[model samples]
Target: DNIWGAVALHNFIEMLRSFFQPVNVHVTIADGNITLKNDALLEILKA
Candidate 1:
């Protein structure tokens, strides 16, 4: 059915996104400098 196919497609997209998406992680120093990938930040915001 259409509903089943939509669910399958959504699952596939999520899987692909997870597999291809990169994570943004940071370690701060006393100097207070920040560095991170924008894509990772966007992903976090999407969640």
Candidate 2:
């Protein structure tokens, strides 16, 4: 049961990581390009 619980927790963490990966990418991109902030905001809004 403990092993299964660990596996479940790992899966949950992986899911969260995948979920936020795109947001992190967008943030990095926006930080790199001040001029693209408007475009990035629009893309985020559309998403």
Candidate 3:
């Protein structure tokens, strides 16, 4: 175990968010807008 584990995880999450967010994408939840991660799945559902 290392002290950088949390920092590493935080970096990974930020990378994942950047990778997933190619489009100007959002989902309309009852509470508020949420980012939709899966582009292919969204396209399939839209069809």
Q: What Cα-based lDDT does every candidate model obtain?
A: 0.50, 0.51, 0.50
| Per-model TM values vs. the true structure | 0.42, 0.42, 0.38
Backbone steric clashes in candidate 1, count: 0
Residue 45: error of model 3 in Å? 32
Per-residue lDDT over 1-47 for candidate 1, one digit per residue giving the tens place of the 0 to 100 score: 24564477568767767887856433222323333346454344345
Which residues of candidate 1, in runs, are more than 4 Å off?
A: 22-47
Task: Count clashing residue pairs per candidate.
Answer: 0, 0, 0
Instruction: Name the regions of candidate 2 deviating beyond 4 angstroms.
Output: 22-47
lDDT of 2 by residue, 1-47 (tens): 24564477568667877987654332222344334425545465346
Model 3: per-residue Cα lDDT over 1-47, one tens digit each: 13364367458667767999655544333313323366554454345
Model 1 local distance difference test score: 0.50
Q: Record all residue pairs in model 3 with backbone atoms less than 3 Å apart, i.e. clashing.
A: none
What's model 2's lDDT at 23?
A: 46
By the lDDT metric, which is better: model 1 or model 2?
Answer: 2
- Give per-residue lDDT, candidate 1, residue 20: 75
In order of TM-score, best first, we have 1, 2, 3
